[model samples]
Target: MTMFTRNDKGQDTASPATAQPVRSDAQPAASPVAETRRPQAQPISSSSAAHGTPSVSVISKALKITGQLESTEDIQIEGEIEGDVRAVSVMVGANAKVKGTVRGDQVQLAGQVEGKIEAKKVILTRTARMSGDVVHQDITIESGAFIDGHCRPEYGKAEVKAPGLKTVVAGS
Candidate 1:
């Protein structure tokens, strides 16, 4: 006599050997549907909506910067800067203040600058208050603008070096 035996209902179930195998061709047919369900991701573009010009860095009125700022793009300042600023294009907004020099390809001022400005083109609006010298290839100063230092059109030109300054003798 056997110690164990299968029940009547259990013996009616299908065995593993009778199970059907999956076809390899079915995988390829379903791949296109899987690909269509997945969404294609894209990269985010520029932040500014304007074209032809790159993104601009804005210095708001409530902020203040103590060190030098250098950029290859444009900059708009409506706050206070204690140190120098260098950019391709620099625009000083009304009521802004800059203590050090500003150097750019194009510099537009409508505020106060206690230091010098060096650029290819400079425009001083009526509300501008500049206390230091301006060196530019071309400059435009409004009638009401206040300037305490000389405006020299000597940018990009070979000018006489100041005394007591070390001059670099190139090709030596």
Candidate 2:
């Protein structure tokens, strides 16, 4: 149910941290898999690449892919995606809708996302309507944004207050 969103630029973004919950203990990791994606192994255009970095990949909206999606570039979800998704950065377009788990280094939600979303930074725009738990390092909920879920900002610093927990904003 996971799909890749490659914009006009050569970058593909999808986070890979939604598969597991936060753990305080260390555990063994999986072996790295070697896959070949370089078709011609040629230099890429500066405009199509991110920050002048070379990239080689293409994913259109007509193709609806499933299962786990992992990438190291920028990705835009314009169609629909189910299951888990991981990438460097993800942008869910206004008409795009995603169900299941979504993970990325940076995620911007403009459409509708159902399920859990984890990222380094998450932005809930005014047009976004989400129904799930969100955990990130930094989060922004716009004035008109509607989100019916729990939120946790990691930042890797102080512990986040959970639901039902007492929280006092500003001064009394």
Task: Please give each candidate's TM-score.
Answer: 0.62, 0.55
Report lDDT (Cα) of residue 97, candidate 2: 76
**Candidate 1 lDDT, 94-130, residue by residue in tens:** 9899999998889999999999998889999999999
lDDT of 2 by residue, 8-69 (tens): 11221122422221221122222111011232233574364435544322334555657655
Best TM-score goes to which candidate? Answer: 1
Top candidate, metric lDDT: 1
Candidate 1, lDDT over the whole model: 0.75
RMSD in Å for candidate 2, one decimal? 20.1
What are the Cα lDDT values of the candidates? 0.75, 0.62
